[model samples]
Target: MSKKGKIISLNDFKENRKLTDPDGNPFTGVCVDYYDYEDEQKEYETRYKDGKENGLCTRWYENGQKEYETRYKDGKENGLCT
Candidate 1:
């Protein structure tokens, strides 16, 4: 999969500090998190729009299986999540 934007730690995403890209702009695009400290396995792939969750968000198992998927709009769930 192609990463669309910045790759930040889950802690940084949760801390929500400024939430800007490397150039000090509002973050837009995908923010990926890993299951391991070394970034070996993907934990989640969430799409963002102006710093809000605004698209299909997916979680994965450490074994590379998808756990669930949820759609969001303006940071809120917009439809059936599965």
Candidate 2:
């Protein structure tokens, strides 16, 4: 399968052509958040490719307060911080 924009599972995101860092490692960031749903892991993690954030990710409290904001590049975080 091409596996592009397929919306695979979290494991898939971590195992597939996962974003890497400057050292060719996995690019990563943590967005801490909260939610009322049963799912406790409400935060979003910023992803990256070659040390750049290039994907959709955000952090908001379960009550709906934006905890943090970020940018991405080709599926990685590369610009700004909030």
Candidate 3:
């Protein structure tokens, strides 16, 4: 794994230092992933945050066909498909 800066402390997770995004968006919080760590070829990936799938998600069929494509919001299904 690649190393980033030191964790420092929770104080770094604050907006008091202009640390947030331009939209004043604060912490993105915890995120989880369904990873294909063993495959040499790319495969479907699903990511979750706030206990929901909240980003670009993809799914594939065993026949090597892509089965799902979509976006998410706050971890819920949102837009686009196939």
lDDT of 2 by residue, 11-55 (tens): 236534454433444545432233543565465555444434466
**Residue 40 in model 1: lDDT:** 67
Steric clash pairs (candidate 1): none
Judging by lDDT, tell me the better candidate of 1 and 2. Answer: 1
Give the whole-model CA lDDT for all candidates, comma-separated: 0.72, 0.49, 0.46
Tell me, by TM-score, which candidate is best.
1
Q: Model 3, range 1-82, lDDT digits (tens) per residue?
A: 1013222112242433212223444334332222343552345655444334467877776555777788877655687776
TM-score of each: 0.69, 0.40, 0.44
Q: After best superposition, candidate 2 residue 40: deviation in angstroms?
A: 14
Runs in model 2 lying further than 4 Å from the true structure: 1-7, 12-56
Best by lDDT: 1
Model 3 scores a TM of 0.44
TM-score of 2: 0.40
Off by over 4 Å in 1: 1-18, 37-39
